[model samples]
Structure formats: structure tokens, C-alpha cells
Target chain A: MKKIAKMVCILVVSLVPTLGHGAFQAIGIIKSVEGEVYLISSSTEIQAVSNMKLISGDNIITGNDGSVGLIFKDDTVVSLGPNSQIEVQDFVFNPAEEKLSFAARLVRGTFSFITGQIAKLAPKKVKLTTPDATLGVRGTKFVVEVK
Target chain B: MNRSLRVLSFLILSSIVTVLTYSGCSKTTVVLLKDPEGKVGHLVVENEAGSVDITKENEATTIAGATSKPAAPKRYSEDKISSQFGEALNMLPTQPKHFILYFKSGSTELTDSSKAQIPDILKTIELRSSEDISVVGHTDTAGNSAYNMRLSQRRASVVRKLLIGEGVRADHIQSTSHGEANPLVKTADNVNEPKNRRVEVVVR
Candidate 1:
């Protein structure tokens, strides 16, 4: 039993250093996944589970019955409805240094967003871009379905 | 303040005149939000329809006809449009914000690479409105439990000092040490794992 735990810990350690080496950090974790949710990073797709760390450049997709919720470092909450696709373009939350930003591209489907500390502190820095238009936040919450 | 009120009343009076004169077509819908303290945000309506500006909180204007100007601003309530904004949280990623500063064997000082990650951690603190922080220190299993506990406490203290020096409110931070009890790498007793001897800082 001890050997198994040790090996598992070793494997996890070896796998972490190879991920997300740039300034793009893991901005949030998967709080819950209802149905089919996949995280596509680089070129490989991995099944997403609760507590899975997500980073920039990762594309999140949900199946017809799928939905995902995430609680970000800035205490911002996000829920992606089914049949949705989203790409995290960039995310930066450095409260001590006062550098906070959030930008994402929602290709299609439905999503509900609650503005985070970044938006509360600096509303102009947050942008949500879709194919037809770009959405900015003045209010704290918005839900949109892109046709 | 009086001048602004006068301008607003004048605009309302003129809009009333325009609506009465041009009340020949579609009905005008005025969506008003109730914010006596006026703490709402502005919304710029620029879809396929003509552009309209809702500058003040909880107020909106809709013209009666296609080419007519918008009617006077009206107040809207929070419950009226609550459903319009979905409740699904759209959160940014949070994983990268968690930072771990590794230590050399038998030393509480940060390793070279860990030293480099400090600036980013400080920057993270600067971005938040308030600090909600946790610092947990650990040591490799190379030493006895008692000694490791003290060592880990020292390490946590070092980080706490740095954070306080860099502007993190001292009271907002909680620090603890788990010497050789929990290991990131799960090394055997008397083994030295750089990853195991570390301090983890979580900021929420």
C-alpha cells in the first residue's frame, strides 16, 4: 500500500513540470462536471473531472447534456451550459502586485458569468469575445447564448 | 448638482413633447431600474437596432419608431432583469495562482528557481481587493519529526515575513507547518526530496 502511494506521488510530480510553463497560469479549477466535458490543450484532449486544474490556451467543450462550473482565484464563478465551446485566451490575477486581467473567446453556446475581482477593480481590462461581437461588463452578471 | 438636474428635467420635457407628437407608431417601452443610491452600471445597446446609451444605472430608453430618438430614461428594478443575466459563473483559471517555494536540503531559504517565482506571487497579491491567504510549510523526511517541525515553522515564518514586507497585511495571513508529515513527493524516511521541503501559499 505504501509503495503504491509513493509511486502515485512520483508519477504526479513527474507530470506537473511539463505543463503550462509560460506566464499563463491555471486560473481556475473544475468545480463540477455534469456530463461530457473535455479539455483540449496543445493537441491532446483529456476528460475533465472535478478539481482538474485548467490553464490558458485550453479549449473547453461540453456535450449536449454537459455543463461545467469553475471558481477562479479571484473568486469569480463561471458556468458553461451544454453544447458550448470556450477558449481561454489569457488570464492574470496578481492581487498583491495589483495586476488582474481576464479575456476569453466563446465560440458558441450558452454561458453565465459573474464578474470577478478584476472586473470589479478594473472593468475595462476584461473582455469576452464571440464571433459576431465582443462583450464588456459594467454590471456584475450576464448570460448570453450566441447563435 | 442643480445644473445637472435642470439639464435632466429639460431633456425629459423635450422627450415628452417628441413622444406626444410622434405617438403614431410602435409603443415605446421604458425599462427602469430602482437604484435610489444609483449604484448600477451603464449599458450600451448597439445590436441590429439603433444604438442607445443607458448612462445612469437602472434606466433605459426605447424609441417609439424605427428612426425616432429614444424616449426619456426610465427606472428598472433588479428583479425585472435578473434572469437576463445567467447565473452560471464564468470564472477565469485559478491554478496558476497557487505558488510553492521550494527549499534546499536543511535550509529554509528559497531555492534559485523558487526565488524567481516570488515577484509573480507579489504581483498576485497586488491585484486583489483584500487578502485571504494560507501558508503551509513542510520538510523532507531526512530529519526527525521534532526537528522538521521546527524547521518547517521557521520556513513558514520566513515566507510570512516576506509577504508582510511586500505589503500583504500581516493580519490577513495564516501560517502553519506540517513537518515531514505530508510530503508532496512521498519520499521514504531519511530521504531528501526538494519538492517535499517546501512552503505552499494559497491566496483566495
Candidate 2:
């Protein structure tokens, strides 16, 4: 009986490594709150169970009723009004020197952006392609509304 | 009278004179003198209220009871891009080139074998395209969250400089460190997982 108990403990210990490997990647943080997700940045409240895919330099905020805002590393800040779905398809950032690259897809929502160093360093590098028109920014601020 | 008292009286008299002068002038005369260059001598309509100032600029036109009209909106055609450039952009990779650099336990530095891939990756980007590139550094959960975040960004910047040195335009690439925000395997802290330390590339 003693031998059997020891063997069982060893088996459980071996399986522990495999069991602890499932966690969601954090892309952003929840900044503030409004009727919906109002403000988002590096400093915001994020629930561990939210399962939102967050990358470095991602700022995401969700409201009680399901509004969201997403800010990316490229200094591209997006505010979602309500019941919107936005995904940060890709993002890259270097904090020490302030370099960044980001790409996001707005499936259905209203969003706004403030261009970051990526747009300033290489204006052509940042591209926001929408259904109607593709927006290319050369260090400018603009808003977009999509249905 | 004392000097101060006299000065005060003079100021009061001047105020009275200025008020009388303004009141004596007709509204039209006041409008004319105020707009010597006639730059502001135009009719303004707000909501239902409308006012017309017949100054020197509009006086040249001999039409009686002429009202100002809102400027016409200029029509603009869409700016077209050359097909050659458009085609080139379309052929580029839509997704970023991802490289997962596994690190030792509690370490942010790249492993020996992983460092070897950096030069080749930089060369490929330099030779293939002239567009901008992006490099993002990531880390696994091995240490404090704040420290991991900074480490990740530093790693990404290292890769960005390497690419720039290999003839890729420095202005064409940007880098960001995404600390431990996006982990490949979301396990508990101090896991020292290899999949976590990675720098991803996207060429646009």
C-alpha cells in the first residue's frame, strides 16, 4: 500500500507540467470607463478571465455592457463605442527607444486613432485598410466609423 | 486740483466723449470706418439673422440688394496610385514573419542557436523589399511582470538594429516590446518556457 501511494504521487507530479500551460496572451490593459469601454492604455484594469488577446503596448478596456477600446504599440489609439469587435492582428514595440509597428482589423465598430512613432518614422509603413478606403497616415490624427 | 484728481477727471471726460462719439455715428458709418480695408465688410447670415455691410469691396459691384452667397464646395477626384506600386504592395506578405526565440529559465537573452537566425532574417528583409518592417519582442513568464515587459522591448530593439544594419532602411522599420502580454503558453510564473521569448517581424 505504501509503495502504491508513492507511485501515485510521482505520476501526479509528472502531469502537473502539462496541466499548467494554458493562459491567454495579454495584448492591452483597460484604462478607464464610460457607458462602454471608454479609455484604454498600458495602465488599466484587466480581468484575468477576460481572455482578451493582449500584446505589448496594447490598451484595451471593456465596459459592463460590452463596449471596448483598443490602443496599439504604433501609437494607434482606437476607441470602440459599443458592441464592437476589434482585433490586434499584430504588434511590435521597443520601449527604450520608442519604436513600434502594429496592425489591427476592425471587424464591426466605430474607432479612432492617434498616430505613433511608426507613422512618423515611416509614414507608408502604417496602413489602415477599410472596406471603402485605405487610409495612409503621415503623422496625422483621424477617425474611422465602420458598420 | 491735485495732479491725481485732475488725471482722474480727464479720464472720466475722455470716456464720456468716446461714448458720445460712438453713439453719434450711424451703424453703417461705424461699420465703414471700422473696416478700412473692407476685409470685414461682408454680409453675415447666422440662422435667421442677417446683416449687410456695404463697404468698399462690395461697392464695386453695381447690383442692387446683392446678397453674399456661401462659397461653393470644391470637387475632388480620388488620387490614383500607379498600378506598379500597388501590385508590388499586394504581393508582399500580409502576415508578419514570426520567430520564436526560446530562452533559458528566468532569462531574456536569446539562446546560442536562436541568435544564429538573426542575420539571415535581416538579410532576407533587406534584399526582398524596400518597404517598412516591424519587430516585436516578447517574453515568457519567468520573472516579475514589469521586468519581463522591459526585457521584451529591449530584445525587439536589438533585432530591429540588426535588420537596419543589414541594409534594411532604418526609417523603414519600427520596434516595440510587448513584455509578457502575449505569451504562447500561458502557464504560471517562472515557467522558463521557450515559446515565450520571441521577436516577430512584419514587412509592409
Ten contiguous residues with the weakest lDDT in model 1 chain B: B27-36
| Fnat score for model 2 | 0.00
**Residues B36-71, candidate 1, lDDT per residue (tens digit)?**
233555544332334565656456554444345555
Candidate 2 lDDT, A1-147, residue by residue in tens: 754444433222211111111233333333223454422334565442221335543434334354443334333444554444455545544322333456665444444444544564445555554332234445333333444
Q: What is the lDDT of residue B44 in candidate 2?
A: 20
Please state the Cα-based DockQ of model 2 relative to the true two-chain complex.
Answer: 0.02
Question: Which numbered prediction scores highest in TM-score against the true structure?
Answer: 1
Return the TM-score for each candidate structure. Answer: 0.46, 0.33
Candidate 2 residue-wise lDDT, B1-204, digit = tens: 999999999999998886555434311110111122223222221111223223332121111111222122222221221121222122112222334455555554668887788776766665544244557677878788999888877787777776766667776665666677666555677777777677776543
Q: Looking at candidate 1, what TM-score does chain B attain?
A: 0.55
Q: Best-fitting candidate, measured by lDDT?
A: 1
Please give the distance, in angstroms, between residue A67's alpha carbon in candidate 2 and its true position after superposition.
Answer: 39
Which lDDT value does model 2 have at A28? 39
